[model samples]
Target: MELNDKIEKALHAEQKDHEISAGWRLILASALGIGFGSVGFATYAIGAFIDPLGKEFGWSRAEVQGAIAFGVGLGGFAAPIIGMLIDRYGGRSIAIYGLLGVTVGYLMASTAGGNLCYFYLAYAAVAVLGAGSGPVSWTRAVAARFDRRRGLALALTLSGTGMAAIVVPPYAVLLVENFGWRVGYVGLACLPLFALPFVLLFFFPAKSGPAAAAAAPVSTDAASAPPTGLTLKQATSSYRFWLLLFSILAMYLGITGIVPNLIPALTDKGFTPSAAAAVQSVYGFSLIVARLGIGWLLDRFWGPAVAALVLTSPVMACLILIGEPNYATAIIASALIGAAAGAELDLLAFFTARYFGIRNYGRIYGFLYTGVAFGAGLGPVAFAYLSDLTGSYNASFQGALVLFALGGTSILFLGRYPNLSAETRPANH
Candidate 1:
């Protein structure tokens, strides 16, 4: 406790001396840690495994993608439990467990022997802890610490995934090219280990900051402040919650369903595999800009409006998909897709905190992210399944247009956001 005070005091002194707040640095560290692990291992790297897994097992695309659906969907269902754990406990233990679990999953995947079930179980180990070390766990600590700039803080945290997308996919491709898919999985397994120390030391701060705890008020101020939003239960009961949930679900389904197939899709369009990876790298750049830009917008304007506007990128990408895209069209289309994909969680987390307030944040956000997970699981399979059935990606891309529009349009109905009071929210929290 005394050590925490000293660190906390020094952090204050640093901020007082006109350096960046230690909280902001911690938020950046959290983003980097999550980007290094979750983004590298789960999101971007998985695409590289699709061909190798299929070639080894003689499985269909949908069959291979089943791992993404089952693992990510199951992880979403597990989120409420993880969120409760976050509320009761700080995110430190959950983050640790998540890293360990993902590592184990990747290790087990590295040992796959052409068995579909083996791959499923391994990826399940990784996704089951989705919320633990992900935005769900990391954002709470950030949210607790920042109010005024919370939108940007959450954006920065989620940008770690963007950074991961930028580097991990191409790097995974390099590993696969040089060593093989098994070795690539093993390499990914080791990524979280490198980030673990940063997470423990900086990402997860003391549960309640010394400054916040000191100024926290008792029950007498409850009526005066009047809580801004609902608990998890109330959130679930409202149309507002359902609107947000389904919107996220629809958007993410369109995203994850197609993302793992990006290289293949591009390669089919006449780009070489290396060129495909470069295109994806460009996508990553666009995703990073969109995430940070959306973050900046949320702090200033209505988030749903920003979401609705950005969500159109996917719609435009889908229209481009209807055509036989050339080099320029493919890259432009990809950048739009990346923009839509990147803005998702930033909007979800930001909207959750804004609409619901901080009281039941962990649990409410957890429930909402289940939509994200469920959509993630549903997407790739649906995409692959549609491709297999239709014998072309044109149908799948056309279908994505509907999903994107639906999600973007749905957010318009969340009603007005209520403002919370500082009395209920302690500063330096």
Candidate 2:
């Protein structure tokens, strides 16, 4: 047998006894879906009560929005550290603990009586929990488990965010309208607590099958690196790390920050609140459609081919917005934007694995998540501030269009790099 053939056999032997078991994938997906769905309810649903909270508490808009910033800021601090922990320990323990934090935060929030500190505490607590339960935990786990279908698994795991976006808003609206904000908060608080019991029951490493099983040490030769992970310091030192960082910043900057702000921007363009909301729903629904569609494509196409297709979506959305058409135009834009948002999360995870080895994935992914936090945290507030300055949504929307196009252009370069799985480095040497 040729030397390369021997290398292939050794790697194949690593997979002889274990593989990512289907049952485990289902459990992880369910845990992610529920945990993410609950957090989604807690985060996005708060908008429904913004007016009511302000009216009752007499707080200014800045003060109210400040609570959101506090939460995001706290997340920025917790996520990277948690990632390091996940790299050192494992994902299951952190996920369970994080869910418990969210439950406690929301429970405290349910009893809050107009005290700003109380609201801040609740939001901050949830932020800490977010580090453990969000994409950083589950997506990394899925990526580590599946190689050929890694992209699809990531898409499935992250589809949780879309699921939350789809279900939470309306549920929150109904809760606030019928039962009152206090009752709504209590219900939301209970969701994380409820999720905790199930995660403890089914989310286990043994369930992940072979991928989670301990492997022998990697050899020094070209053929040796195992599919699992590395220490945090070793991960950061690689050239692949920088590539992943730039890729994330290029793609994530506009998408995470701009899409949420689209809700208010559409309303500003003469659409009624209900019509604007419907448009938002269209965008959220697109995520569900796009993720499934992209997952299918990832299994068959090269990563960049699928990536380019996904990147085009935001450009289409921006074009629709610039056209300044009627409600139908707005809805179309929303759908495209939704698709782009849906695909980015999975693609980012794919990019990380495609560019970097899966060993040390948690820390590397956590660092990447920090960039996501920066984009998500700053995007809406920056857009809102720009709207105030420009006195129009069109100008702000146009700015987003430029950024979206730039992100699309970046994906074209991805095809030029050597496949990380092959153990060859990019020519940037």
Q: 160-279, model 1: which lDDT tens digit per residue?
A: 887877888898899998899999989888888877887767765545333434445554433223233456786788787888888999998888766777777776667777788777
The lDDT for every candidate, in the order shown, is 0.76, 0.63
lDDT of 1 at 342: 77
User: Which segments of model 2 are wrong by more than 4 Å?
Assistant: 1-43, 58-63, 112-117, 206-240, 269-275, 322-325, 389-392, 415-429
User: Ten residues in a row with the worst lDDT in model 1?
Assistant: 219-228
TM-scores vs. true structure, each candidate: 0.88, 0.80
TM-score of 1: 0.88
Clash pairs of candidate 1?
144-429, 145-429, 257-379, 257-380
Measured by TM-score, how close is model 2 to the native structure?
0.80
Which predicted model would earn the best lDDT?
1
Residue ranges of candidate 1 with Cα displaced over 4 Å: 1-20, 37-41, 129-131, 206-229, 421-429
